[model samples]
Target: MSGCCGPAPDGRYSEIFDERFASSIARRYRRRGLTAPEGRIIEALSGLGLHGRSVLEVGGGVGELQLELLARGAAETVNLELSDAYEQQADELMRASGVDGRVTRIVGVDLAAASDADVARADYVLLHRVICCYPDFAGLLGAAADHARSAVVFSHPARNLFTRAVVAMSNARMAIVGHDYRGFVHSPEAMLGVLRAHGLALRTYERSKRWHIAVAVREPAGVRTAPAG
Candidate 1:
């Protein structure tokens, strides 16, 4: 979640995404990755047939999802991040899991800017808390579905008045501070439309007070779901 309060006095908005304090964030990531939200994500994944499959997690800032996917028998996982800040800490966590070689992290790239080779299709693709970070929902999500061989799972802000106020406040503060970081409140129906257009079928849906997760799997062999506008 975007901090309830704006960035700290120390330009933490920028530094938080840089190496300056990545270790601290990484530590927090390690702790929180094992919590309820992540649990729900894993629960949704239980039926994805992830065993020995490949995974790609966009905006997987701290590698938590990748680690968990590996633990659940994913053969390999790629982390597509928008910053290089987590390089050291992310690598360290992988080393700790003894799966360092199987995790490929492409830092400094977002889906809109990533190459086909950079994102090479995987059995499962994840976008936890990532949709709200990037402004281009269509481009980003379209790319996600294109890169997913079997299914795509993602979490985004729930469209509600409370979330609207929080995003508004956060954006206003960031604007005043001259920071480029901003969050979005996109339509779930439209998002489902994008997934549907990709020929993916909605398989499951889960939500928390602030976030919602949608898991869509590719249509069965020889079948295709009609795309929705």
Candidate 2:
């Protein structure tokens, strides 16, 4: 999963995903492998053909999902992160897994605002637990779709009474702690619409108790080129 908090526009919220938080996340991955939601994402992407493909994961913490993709025969992966804290642990994990050469970590770059050169396109794009952290889902998902040549898969809190309450309480706690980070509950239908507007069609939708997993694939050439919206 991505870090617990969203990155501020100025990128000054590094403390939210600081070294301590990064380490804890890394340690958990080392001990427990992918989380349940993350496992679901991998399962969905695996069916889409990962062999020799490249992946770009936005806000990927410790690059665990990328590692899994590599193990499943991905050629390489680029991890874009807002906080630099995850780099150290991600590097250690990559090196320990003997895949350091196949991974690139780009830190402190907001994909929505990054230059084309900074945001490289890939065969598969992933955003595990990222949509909720970003308030502007359109900007984030648009950039993600622009960079994806084949597919985009993301997980977010399901829009419902239970998840809404969770987000509300989480935001309240952040406010109480003086954190600028916030959690959002964007509508799934609207989010999928963003992908369709970018020429990607929704292929799969799955849900657990709290999160919704969505997988969208790029439309074939000369087919579905116009935005339905």
Highest TM-score among the candidates is held by which one?
2
Model 1 pairs whose backbones collide: none
Q: TM-score of every model? A: 0.87, 0.91
State the lDDT of candidate 2 residue by residue for 117-183, as single tens digits: 7677999899988888888999999999999999999998878888789889989999898888888
Clashes of each: 0, 0
Best-performing candidate as measured by lDDT:
2
Every candidate's lDDT:
0.78, 0.85
lDDT of 1 by residue, 1-229 (tens): 1111111222322444777567876787766656667778987786777788998888777687778778888888888766657677887888888888888876555666667855688988999888887788988888999899999999988999999899999899988977877888999998888988877898888878877999999887778776644
Q: Quote the lDDT for 211 in model 1.
A: 75
Error of 1 at 111 (Å): 1.8
For candidate 2, give the lDDT of residue 52: 92
Runs off by more than 4 Å, candidate 2: 1-12, 225-229
